[model samples]
Target: MVREVITYPNPILRKKSKDVEVFDQKLHTLLDDMNDTMKQHGGVGLAAIQIGIDLNVLIINIPLDKEGSEDDGKQLDENLIEAINPVITHKDGELVFTEGCLSIPGFHAEVTRAENIIVEYFDRQGQKQTMEANDFLAIAWQHEMEHLSGHVFIENLSFLKRKKFEKEWKRYLKENSKK
Candidate 1:
């Protein structure tokens, strides 16, 4: 099931998500729905908070081609990664890239993030797992992590840029309201 994605300015998007304690069938369903929702929205990642759920869950599916050629000269397959209670245990270097969020609709901003990260998380089966990611995968992980922490990409923008984005977002909302 593709869930409705909560957009920017929604209070739920600003509220921190609660940690998932029981990894039951419901959690499995949420992860499945989140994957469907992410694909439906053409997003490489999605957080539970984006779908009005206050759980620390996120899914990522970064295409191999987007991982950058400079990333250890290795290619990854298109794998669905479901992370519950993900934590960034380590970060290395930094890179700035233009990023967009499903909740933010048609806005994009240059956001700086760790170029590489070691994340510890639980898979859908509730097994403990850890992986080292770099480049786009790293960015995607960090992006969804921010969502779980009640923040959007615009928060990383400069004050003037954020203001500009807020104005544009308001205009967009107003224009859409007429129809």
Candidate 2:
């Protein structure tokens, strides 16, 4: 089942997630739930913090958004997916993109990130794995990894940019409050 994502101003998002030591049933379930939640909400990625869990866990899948692909029965880009914990060992090639978060609704900011990276993580089955990603994959990994470190994408914004978003952020919070 998809879980409710905790929004910003929730203290859980501020605490760094604890590392996973035991690869067990609960870890497996959490990964499943995260994937379910992310797809349900049209999110590209999800972190344990978004689900109010404090663990070094996050999942990312960045499929290219091609028009009408979902409606035309076209096969999904398999390269666009896989679950990971994402420890960056090497990074190069920088780019900036405007990023938003599942945990911080209606807010986005430009964040500079490595365009390429080598990462180590576990697969869905808890098998230790490592991979190198460039371009979109690297950006997606960096974005999701920030959650495990108790950082939100908006934090990459300057104070002025954050201020610019404050009005819309408040409006989103207010609308969501009624739900």
TM-score of each predicted structure versus truth: 0.91, 0.85
**Candidate 1 lDDT, tens digit per residue, 37-143?**
98888888899999999999999877545533433433243477899999999999999999999998988899999999999999878899999998888999999
How high a TM-score does candidate 2 get?
0.85
Q: In candidate 2, what are the lDDT values of residues 18-90, reduced to their tens digit? A: 8777778888888878888987887877888789988878877665446523333232445334444658899
C-alpha lDDT values of all predictions = 0.90, 0.78
- Runs off by more than 4 Å, candidate 2: 64-85
RMSD of each: 3.6, 3.4
Error of 2 at 140 (Å): 1.1
**Which candidate's TM-score is highest?**
1
